[model samples]
Target chain A: MEHAATAPEPGPARVAELRRSRPRSPLLRFSALAGVALLVWAWAAGDIYESHLTAEQKGANLDRFLAKLTPAPVRESGDWSDFAPWAVRLLGEGRGAEAVLLTFALATAAAALSGVFALIFLPGAARNLANPDPLGIRGGRGGLAAAGWHAVSRCTRAFFVFTRSLPEYVLGFLLISVLGPDPWALVLALAVHNFGILGRLGAGVGENTPPGPARPVVAHGGGRLGAYLSALLPASFNRMVVYFFYRWETCVREATVLGMLGVVSLGYLITDAKSGRAFDQMVFFVLLGALIVLAGDLLSALVRRWLRYERT
Target chain B: MNGALQRCAGSRRATLLGIALAALLCGWLLGLDPRRLFADGTLGLAGEFFSAAFRPALSYEDPVPGAQPFLLAALRSLLDTLRFAVLAMAVAVPCGALLSFFASSAWWPDLRRHRALGLALRALHSTSRAAMAFARSIHELLWGLLFITAIGLSSEAAVIAVAIPYSGILAKIYSEMLEEHARDAQEALRSIGAGGLAAFAFGLLPRALPDIVSYTFYRLECALRTAAVFGFIGIETIGYRIRLASDEFHYREIWTYLYLLFALVALIEWWGAAIRRRLKT
Candidate 1:
């Protein structure tokens, strides 16, 4: 304890010293790329809606997509069309609790895998985000106020760069192209995307560790990576749990949408039902997906409370 | 003490790199290779096809019946794409937000709420997320295809395909946002005996409202893109038009529509960003 009293005060000199050196810039490149991608996505969506479907076609599509699968078959209705009703009917099959359970089970597994990856990525991110600047000093001159504001602005940029950089669909699109239509393809796609997401959160939580621990370790000849793991990761442990539960829930939604690659989750079921004109079954799958999202929310909430209880 | 290059030789990085390589391998198996066009002479054929996409000359003759209604048809396809995306966002946001509360930590304080309540809520939350995730995993084209087969080729089919997944996405994202801000304000509001609904309204809503709107716009943009892609299957959406024009050797129409789609996305981003800035202030 007495060893701490001899520690030198880190002031503007130290601030200037740290600021002179470069900060890693990979994060910046990723942010810019993400911004560009988002713009492109927006342009594509805006230019392509109205002319996609004709009035008559739109009516028939909606009806068929919503139809329910029955034991009985139906004759084709219009003179201009030769569309079959099997896809929607198969999707809109009977409302079995078992089907809902099966769907949820698959989605949960996917989410859990992403959560595990998030856990793996957290330690690395936390270390990289450790601020070298000392506490109680200004961010600009030598005061606390400047430091606080700088931190906020930098963090905000990072946050935006993180969340908006990649959409799940884009990831799914890329992965589906690469990994085929398997269920694991969707899972892997969601996982990589989630990795980027949770990594940013982990970095934010670890941003407050004082430089003392990291500086001392580095000065004593320890590697930068060592200082990061020891000082940064440990400091942010408390916040990791909260983000974990939250991300897991998100994975569930991603799993559903990404599963549109013919990987049978409830979404696949919905599409099939819609194709078969199985209205009731389509509704069932939609409702079922909604319900599963709700359950993930609750589970995460429970996990959060448990973490808080542990902390207390 | 160690060199940066030396540090890079760790087992973890190698493992990560290996895993990525495997994923790449799997991706290869999926047949998503854009290079396939060249190998099959498909690229040269595509060039010829897309050349016509530009043919219907951007003359004053367009929108007049004689030469080609190129400009008008392009504009019309663009509108349809925008409409599909907007409508999908409309359906997705509210439902996602409303359900987000249930998914958020704001609802469950402890794992043991009550004997039956805990079990029931647990089931409900899990099911909701699972359902959303699974639903969203499907592609819009497939969704369109599914709907097309069931309901026949129509805009409604496109809308359903887009909405189902976007809803899952919005709900998941919104819930995560809520949980990240679950402390303090929420706790204080709860301490005041605010009901769940009241606490959400008084404490959380204000902070999240702007972000929610921004993301909704973002999702709208995404849905539009997905809807366009779906247009390739059967729908006459912008994507479908581009594909059709290209297929029919109408390069001018294809270029016109594709550019229109790109422009619309930029405009939405600009407007959305402006609104976000205003809100921030």
Candidate 2:
């Protein structure tokens, strides 16, 4: 009898709370509906229906390509033994070994360069620091001072977004054109894109860092820079390193293909093989690139796992 | 306290040493020379390229008689890129969701209640995980090249190529999200006599849905970039036009296309952010 009386009393209030918590805003519904409509329109107007070939023709084309994929020497001798020597010769004489090394080196150099650059520039992008009163420390109360800080913050964020938006391949292509296909162009392209990403990520880390440690630094008159360097940086170091490794793994994958821009990496070798109509060699290089990416992934995962353990 | 501080300093120093060693190795392998960055005429070319970025072309840098307008060409390229990205996502999302179920062990029956079924599910889980790893190891561009080789470069082949790696990525993340969420609600529902799938759907899915959606949006953004990259292989996306403009030394035209791509990405990011905020409520 007591449960029934109390339940009845709170039922209406509880229902009201539930109703308020649900996402029933008309604008949200409209936006979701609009998104689905746009997708439907995209499919209707897409260029995916361009091929006029019948199904048999498509199958035949695939079969012909598969036939070409058999290594030429192996096909002639009808023996799998010829394949091993051919692959060994390809690695020894076709510069495959050098290209593999170059791919890894390019990724490491770009990742390290970007990590350094991002660390240097991220303070300007951090919301907590770019304000007039950093770390919640009161400063001169002037509208002009606030406006200036806001503009700086906005411009820095916009710059990061703009650089991040430019696909690395596109940037590499543009850079290679002006730089005459130099390795520097590839390195710069990868670094610039990753720098923007890391800057954004590192700024987020700064904003999300607990205010407790940083407040004491500000109270001691260490200034925003000192507080950031001494407190926030150390607090977020493991996370930033984790992000760095994640980006490095991506860089390795990208470096594998960025070589198709006419540099010498796994991608360049693969492209060369494709043009030479050596399907066997092309597939081999592609698999080798995949292997490198998997290795990079494993290494990054292990480091990230260690970092997570450190946090606990 | 003193020993802990010393250990921290030692680790920091070691990390720095490792980075230095890696950078030196990279420099040696790449034959890197700082002097080459400022080689003769390089500064002039770079200056010309950056200057054009400020004044993106409103039309063709060099006109040809009776040619289509530059803006029309750019618009077409933009739409094609969007279409390709959307199509790839449409295929990848469903495939990924299906693969995720097999990959994730969260919904498995209790081992004590059903030993044979549990072992079989474990076997399926491992195989799905291995497949996902292999699929994700290859970059989408490489996958595109492989598909083009195998199937003669049709639109379907291109779409499939992009979809393959994307599905694996989405599946991996989705499974992780499912596994990461707290199982309190699921356990409660199960205790109340709900079916296993029902308990998972109502309890876990709701908690993980927002993250899964947010990640899918991020993947869509990536797909747009990948679609542009596909143009290099002759798919008539924005990258294709950029390549064409570059070939003719039309840096301004390249910038124009680049700005359009950036605007599209920024708009999508804003929309995704707004949706995520709403989901949080």
Candidate 3:
């Protein structure tokens, strides 16, 4: 009887059986309605009909534009010699190597500063760690202290929201006006954004921490701060490191974007190449940026591996 | 045990030293100078910029002739940004889904049993993966600039620029989601003689659909941000106006544009959280 039940049914019966077993999903219907609404919105917004040029004309134009972007043969033989000089020029006069180094420096500085800021604000922001009365005190003194801590927690949370909401690009723009187009502007912008992200993540890790280790600290007459410092932070350290590395990856990417704002990074080279109509050079710079980002990703992966190995 | 502890301590020191050396080299190579940080008038300028936030221009006056009023213009720009983002996602999400179907290893369950066919499928999967990586490696800002150069300042350029990299990202993520969830279901279906596509549709897709939807909503929020950034490259979105105001020292106007952007992002964040919550339940 078990063997018979396990066997596949015939086609018609199998289809019916499959249909009967399928779970009802309202999400599908909701998504379809949302998609249709999006389409109607797009239509009304005139994005669908915004372009005046016909499709064929646009295609021809795009083809021509791409044709213009293609680099001309540098030598009669069409060999590597044609590209060697450009590469050399990019490294020497264009300061491609310097740009890469600067990008790395900016990212590292930002990550370091953000890590510090995140640590400073993390206890206050974390819902669990910031609890007003972890000791279950019922007196007037405990109530007042609890109220004060709650206010601090609320303020820190609001700070995180405000900082993270502003994009690094906007921050870079604002910083440039004040800092006079120096590298510090980009560094601070990246730091501010990542600080918020890391702090929020740290707070989340704090909230979800298992009570097994921290409870003892509190039960032993340790203050809330003592419990957090001795137990909660130690427990969440690894997760905080993970978040920091993740943010570091993004910081490298943002550093490149910040270059477009006149900070002498790889982006600046790309911008210059574009203005000069040197499409080949622009492509080269973009490839270089990609390499730097890939290297940063590789480094992060290695660090994560090392951390895991150490843990084990 | 003592020796082992000493060796572990030595290794930890070595790792720390290595990291410190790398940091030092990077800093030195970049000529990291902090003396210029406190340039003349820096504090005053920053103060002014911050103060403007509290007094954002809320007037109905049009900055450009024949344009809408201040609030109306902001709303219009927000709509445009949304429209571009949605259209880009519409293009990206389907293309990404199709690509992921080809890219995911779980979709090709017969690969191990059939050597030649497996080789072909594996090659296709690797190629698709590489293509997606290359597509997303270049940031959207670069893509926007490239499209602007390729086709001039047009909405199509903005939409296409946003679409390409986002499609790559979606494809990479979607493939991972499918692969992670499809294993058990795929085996069950294959045991019953269902074909790859059938197994995927009936088995893998349902389980992965929730995660994919949630991620897509998160990507939508990202796309909105990207669209605003694209405006800085001269697409006439909110960022473009903000840039204009900033360039002309109209800090209040910049704040106004920024507030609109913040409201939009906040709304999307709320919606995304709601959808994710629903998915969880």
lDDT of 1 at A60: 65
Off by over 4 Å in 3: A1-32, A48-77, A133-158, A309-312, B1-35, B38-40, B60-67, B179-195, B198-204
Q: Evaluated with DockQ, which candidate comes out highest?
A: 2
lDDT (10s digit) by residue, model 2, range B1-281: 89986776677667767877997789778877888888778989999999999999989989998988999989888988988998899999998898898998777666789889888989999988988888888889989998777767778888989999899999999998998899999999989988778888998998999899889988998999999988888888999999999999999999999999988888888888888888878
lDDT of 3 by residue, A1-312 (tens): 999999896899899999998765575567669879987787566642255667677677678656645444553446666677768777888899888878888888788778878888888888766776563432235767778878988889867766766678777887888778877788888899789778988988888888678777777777667878878876666666677787888788778768998986778888888888777778788888878877887788788767666643
Better of 1 and 2 by lDDT: 2
> Can you give the TM-score per candidate against the true fold?
0.50, 0.94, 0.84
Docking class of 1: incorrect
Query: How much lDDT does candidate 3 score?
Result: 0.76
Clashing pairs in 2: none
- For model 3, what is the alpha-carbon lDDT of residue A7? 89
Task: Go through the candidates in order and give each one's C-alpha lDDT.
Answer: 0.57, 0.87, 0.76
Judged by whole-model lDDT over C-alpha atoms, candidate 2 comes out at: 0.87
Which residue pairs in model 3 clash with each other?
none
The candidates, ranked best first by TM-score, are 2, 3, 1
